[model samples]
Target: MPTSASQEALTPLRPYCGRFAPSPTGRLHRGSLAAALASRLDAHAAGGRWLIRIEDIDPPRDIPGAGEDILRTLERLGMPSDGPVLWQHDRLDAYAAVFEDLKAKGAVYGCACSRKEIRAAAQALGLPEGVYPGTCRGGTGGREARAWRFRVPDRDVTFVDRLAGPYTQNVEKAVGDFVLKRADGLWAYQLAVVVDDIFEGITDIVRGADLIDNTPRQCLLYEALGAPVPRYMHIPLVLNDRGEKLSKQQGATPLADDDLLGELERAFVHLGFERIGADSIEAFHREALRCWADRFAEEPA
Candidate 1:
C-alpha cells in the first residue's frame, strides 16, 4: 500500500485561482468592500485570475436584485472580476452529483434529527456544543426525513493559512458530521462551496475572518471528494462599536457610488496600504495599485 504521505502527494496541484464568493443577502457594505478589494488585489498582484461567485443557494434569505447591486458596486469600485460571475443557484445538479458520489463511497448517511433533539443531545453528552450532536451517527435519531450529514472520522484536519498562519480542528468534536444537504432540500455551504471551487478550478480563497473556523470542515470535505485543497487567507473582520461583524443585518451603511474613491481609500488604509491622498477615485486607483505593487515587490518570499 502507498504510504499516507505519498498518497497525499498524488493529489493534483492547481494554479493560483482566487475567488470572492458573496451572499446576495444585501448590498455591499464597508466590510464586504474591504474583502473584495483585498482578494482582487491579492490575485492580481500574484499574477493569478480572480473570479466572483454569487452565493444564492438559500432562496428564502436571498434579497431580490441584491446580486446585481453587488456586481454594480464592484464595477463602480474599479475592481471587476474576470469572466462571467458564477451563481450558486445554477449549480444544484453539480452539488447533487458530488453528494451521490460521497454517498456511494459510504462517507455519508441520512440524518433525521430535529434541531431541538440535536441541541438537547449535545448538552447531555457534553459535546463541544453545536447544532448537531451526531445523535444520528448510527442512524437512530427517531425522526423523519430531514437532511444528510457527512460522517466525520476521528482525526484532526489541519492546514496552513496564507494570512492567519497554521491551524487545526477536530471535525468530530468541533462539528459532528456536518450537513451536506439541509432539511429544506438545499445544499449546505460546505458541500456547495467545495463542489463549486473544484468545478471552477479555484486554488486560493480570500474572505473575512468569520470563516476561519470553517476551514477545517471544508478541508475534510475536499479530502473526501479526493480533490486538491486551496490556499486560504482570512482577513480581519471589520467590526462595529458593539464588537460585532459589520453586515446588512447590523445596519451597516452601503457603499454609495459617489463615495467610491473615499470608500476605496478607507479600505486600502484599513488593509495597511500607504501612499493614498484625498484625490479623485480614478487617481486613487492608479496610485494605490502602484504603491501596492511596490510594497509587494519588496517583500521577500
Candidate 2:
C-alpha cells in the first residue's frame, strides 16, 4: 500500500520532473508550444528534469517527420529537454506488459461493439444523457478480436489540479469502460500514457485543459498497475474565434520557424506568465524561471 508521505512527495511544487507528451499527428502549433513551455519552466524552476515524449502509438495518424519537426521547434524556442526523448512507438513491450497484468487482475476485458452499435445502444437505452453504458461488459464473443476496455469502479476518482482546483469524476459514469487497445490494433492513449508516465517516473503533468477529464481514468490505471500517480496542472486551452480549441484537425496553423521568439513570448503570456523585459529567447527563459521560482516560494504546506 502507498503512503500519504509518498503522495506528498509527488507534488508539482516539490522537486519538479515534468514532461510534454505531444502527438505526432501534425506540426507544433501555439497550443503545443504553450504546453511545452509551461512544463519545461515548471520543471526547470524547481531544478528538476524536463523530458519530452512523442506520442506516436497511433501510426495511422502519425506524420513522417512531425516528431522531428516538433523537437527542432522546441530547441529553437530555447526549451530543450534534459534527456533523450521517449518515443512511445519504441515502448510497445512496456505497454503490453501492463496490459497483461491488468487482464490477469480481471480489470480489463474485450468489447466487440462498433461505433454505430454503441450509438444505437445508447439511444435505445434512453440514457444518452452522457457517458458509456457498458453494454458489452461481460463479453460480446470470442469470434472476433475487438477493443479492450478497463472496468471502472462505482466510486469517484478525485484529484486536485494546481490551476483548476478540485475535480471529481465518477469513473463508472463520467467515462464508462474506456479503451485500452483500439480495434485498429493500436494501444489506446489512456493505457500507453499511464505506462509511459510511470516508466519515465514523471512527477508533474502540465498539459491542455482538454485532458483534464483524462486524469481520473489515468489515476485508476495507476492504482490498478500499483504505480504512483503524478501531480497534474491543466493550463487553459488556446481557442479559436468560434470558441473551439485549436487543433490540427481544425487546420490550426503551425508555428513558423522565423517567429520562434515571438511565438514563445505569446505562449508564455497565454500561460499566465508575466513578461519581465528582456528580448532574446534565452532572456525570456531566465526571467520565466525566476518568476516561477518566486511565485511558488510561498506555496502552503
Candidate 3:
C-alpha cells in the first residue's frame, strides 16, 4: 500500500526520491521545464533525492541526438540529477524480469489484435473508441503475439493526488487489457514505469495533469507486483493556444537559449510561485524549497 498524498505524515520512507522523466522527442518546452522545476522543488523541499530518466524506449521515433540535447538543456537550466541518470534502453533486462513476474501470476496475456481490428471491435461492441475491448484474452496461436497485455478487473483503483484531489479509474471498463509490450517489440510505458519506480524507490510522482489518467493503470500494476505505490501529484498543464497539452507532437518549441537562471525563474513563476522582487536565483530557490516543504510536509501524527 502507498501513503496517501493527503498531506499526512507519510510513513517513514527510504528518505524520499523523485524524478524528471522526459521522452527526448524534442527540446524542453515551457511545459516540460515547469514539470522539471516542480519535481526539483519537491525533492529539495523534502530533503530528498531527485533523479532523471530518459524514456527512449521506442527506437523508431527517437531522434538520434535528442537525448543528449535534452541533457544539455537541463544542465544549462541548473537543475541536475543527484545520482547517475538512468536510461530506459539500458533497463530492458530489468523490465523483462517484471514482465516474467506478471506472466507467472497470469496477470498478462498475449494479444495479436491489430489497431484496425480493435477499433472495429470497439464500434461493434458499443464501447468507447480507443478503449481496447479485450479481444484476445486467450492465445492467438500460429500468429505470433503482437503485444502483451495486462488483464484488468472491473474493480476501481482509487488514489488521491496531492494537488488534483481524489481520482478513480476502473481499468477493465475504462481501458481493457492494456499493453505491456508493444507490437513494435518495444516495452510499454505501464510495465516499465512500475518496474522503474520500484527499482528507484520513488516516493512521489509529480508531473503534468495530462498523465493523471495513467495513474490508476500504474497503480493496478503496482498491486500485481505486490509493490508499494507512490504518492502522486498531477500539476496543471501548460497548454498551447489550441487547448492541447504542450507536447513535441504539437510542434511545441523548445528552450532556445542558455539563460538558465532566467528560464528557471520564468518557469518557477509559471507554476504560480511567488518571488520577492530582490531575490536572486539562489534566493528564490531557497525560499521556494521552504514553501514546497511546508505545503507537502507530512502532518504531525
Q: Which candidate wins on TM-score?
A: 2
Q: Which ten residues in a row have the lowest lDDT in candidate 1?
A: 1-10
Alpha-carbon lDDT of model 3 = 0.81
Model 2 ranges off by over 4 Å: 1-15, 141-143
Please report the TM-score between candidate 2 and the true structure.
Answer: 0.93
Model 3 lDDT-worst window of ten: 1-10
lDDT of 1 by residue, 16-93 (tens): 678888999999999998899888876777677889999999999899999999998888888787868999988999
Cα lDDT listed for each candidate = 0.80, 0.83, 0.81
Assess candidate 2 and give its lDDT: 0.83
* Backbone clashes in model 1: 0
Q: Estimate each model's TM-score.
A: 0.91, 0.93, 0.92
Residue 93 error, candidate 1, Å: 0.7
Better of 1 and 2 by TM-score: 2
Per-residue lDDT over 25-138 for candidate 3, one digit per residue giving the tens place of the 0 to 100 score: 887888999999899898778778999999889887788889888888887666778988999999999999889988998999999899999999999999998899887886
Tell me the lDDT of candidate 1: 0.80
Between 1 and 3, whose lDDT is larger? 3
lDDT of 2 by residue, 46-78 (tens): 789999999999888899999998998888888
